[model samples]
Target: MGYPGLHRILWTREQFAVFRDASGQSYVVDAYCPHLGANLSVGGRVMGSCIECPFHGWQFSGKDGKCTRIPYAEKVPEFAKIKVWPSCEVGGMILVWYHCDGVSPTWQVPEQEEVASGAWVFHGTTEHFVNAHVQEIPENAADAAHLSFLHEPWIMNGVDLRHTKSKFWRFMKHHWKAEWQPEPDMHCSCLIVKHSLTIFGKHFPLLDMMISARQIGPGLVFLIFQHDFLGCGVMIHSVTPVEPLLQHVTHRIYYQRSVPSIIPKFLLWAESIQFERDVMIWNNKQYLSKPLLVKEDAAIQRHRRWYSQFYSENSPKFPSQNTGLDW
Candidate 1:
C-alpha cells in the first residue's frame, strides 16, 4: 500500500524466524520443509524457478511447492513433500496470506493505482526493522499528537500541532485513519491522508499518510506502508515468540516526492533525516514496560488501542517455538 516494491524482510518477531523472499517475481514458501522439518530458509537458495534446500540438495519449485528434482532421489521420492505459498509482486510489494492453518483464504495485498502509475513519480524504497509490532506502527499514520515529540512539527512545513484537528476515521474493519486540520501558521497549509481504501472508497476511509516522495505529480505520495506478512509478526511474518512480552519488528519505507520543483526532493531528504531520529526514539522505547495512556500519547495510545485487536496473549496460534534457536 505504501510503494510498489517487494522487500524480503527477514525478521525475528516474538523470537520467531521469518524470511520475506521478495524477488521481482514473488513466490513465498514456508521457511521449513514439511518433510524433514528442515529450515529451508536457513540454507534455502533461489535459482531460476526453484528454491533449493541446502540439506541433501533437495530443490523445491516456488511455483506450487512441487519438488522439481531431488539429486539423490531416483524420481524425487514420494515422501519429499513441501508446502508452498504462491505469492506475487504487483506494485513493487510482495503480498502473501498469513493463515497458519495452511488454508489460503480470499485475502488481497494492499495496492493503489498511484503506486506505479505513470502519473505519479516512483522512487525506490528503503527497508528497515523496528523493535515493535506492525499492528503498533501503522497506527502512527493516524497519530497526530506524536508529531510534536517524535517528529519536529516545525520541520513539517510548520504544522501547528496546537491547532490541528483530530478526527475519527474508519477505512475497514482492520484499518483506521485520522485527519488533522492544518493551521494558518503551520508550514504545510493542509494535512490530508489518502491511503487505506475501504470496500469501495467511502466504506474505508484512511487519511492517506503520504504514499511516496519521489516526485511531484497528481499520484506522487510521500509515505506509504503495507504489511508484508510474507512469513509472521504483523499477520504471519512474525515468527518469533520469546515470552509474549517482547516481539521483533521489520518495516519498509516506500517514500516519494509530491511537488514538481526541487523542493520535493529537499523534503524527501529532510524526511530521511527525521526518519533516523524517529528510529532512535522508537527503538529505545521500553516496549515491554507498558505505559498508561496520556494526552500527549494520543496517537501512540491510538496505536495501542488499534493493536489490541490482536493483543490477546492467549490466541491458540503462537510462534512455532521450533526455529532450532536456543534463545
Candidate 2:
C-alpha cells in the first residue's frame, strides 16, 4: 500500500494511485503524473496535502488532484488537475464511489454496530480472484440447494447423507429460508437466510444458523452469521470488477472477543475452503441473464430484481407503502 505515501492499484481495467497525507487523509486519483506521465504513486512524496512528483518535483493537491507546484515553470496551468474519484474514509476502510453515468452517490455506507461495538476484533481476511462477473457472484446466496448439495456439511463428516434421503427428509435436514428486505429509496437490501445442518452427525443435534447479509449496492456485502455453536461473527465481503471476466474479492472476518478466538479462526479457515467449491464452478460457468428456474429458485429472481436498481437508468425507488418487513 502506498498510503501516508503512495500505493499503486488497478480496478475496472484502469491503473490508479492512492495517497494518504500526514493528517491521515486519503485520496485516489490517476496513477501517472500529468506532466511527464511518470507513475506518481511509486515515487511520489507527500508534502502536506500535495503529492510531489518524483521526476520534476511537480506537486499535485490530494483533494482536487491539481498541479499546485512546479519547480521550473513560470505558472501552474489551470487544466493541471488530475481526474479525482469521489472517495471517503469510513470504518477504517477507504471507499471510492463510482458511477457509470457520472452521478454522485445518493446513499451512504451505513455504520455497523458489530464492528463499532468494540466487542469484535478482526479475526482474519481471505482474498480470492474470481473469473466471473461481480453481479453473478452474490447470487449464490439465493441458491439454497447448493448449500445442501455442493457444500453439504455431512460430506465434511464423511457421511453421504443424500443417499439415505427422502425428499421430505432432505428438506427437513437443512431448513433454509431467504427473505429480501429492500430499503426504500436506497441502493441496498438485506438478504437474511436461516438454515441448519447436522455438523455432529448422530452425536449432537443440528447446528442452527442465521445469516444477515446487508448488501450495499452490488460491490459491498456485509454479513453477520449467528449460530448455535460458534456464536455470532461478521464478514465484510468486498468485490471490485477488474474486467468483464475477472473480479477481485476480499473477505474480512470479525468475531466477538468473548468467545474463544480459535473457534472463529478455525471457522474462517473452513469457510475459506468451502468457498473453493463455488470458485471451481464460477470459473467455468457462463452467465445467463434469463436462467431456467424451479420452485426453489424464487430467491434468485428476487435478488436479481433488487440488483437491477444499481444498473438501471433511474434512481432507486420503492413503493410508498411500507411492507412491515423486519431486518
lDDT of each: 0.41, 0.74
Clashing pairs in 2: 2-6, 2-7
Which structure among the candidates has the greatest TM-score? 2
Residue runs of model 1 more than 4 Å from their true location after superposition: 1-9, 13-24, 31-48, 53-57, 99-106, 127-129, 133-136, 149-153, 156-264, 288-303, 311-327
Encode model 2's per-residue lDDT on 181-295: one tens digit a residue. Answer: 7667567777788765543244234467788988888888888878777788888888888765688888888888888989778867766666766787788787677789998
Please write out the lDDT profile of model 1 over residues 77-189, one tens digit for every residue: 66565655545454543544443344553433334455445334444334345554333344444466555454522243322333222222222222223353322322111
TM-score of predicted model 1?
0.52
For model 2, the superposed segments whose C-alpha errors exceed 4 Å read 155-175, 199-206, 227-229, 312-327
- Give the least accurate 10-residue stretch of model 1, judged by summed lDDT: 230-239
lDDT for 268 (candidate 1):
43
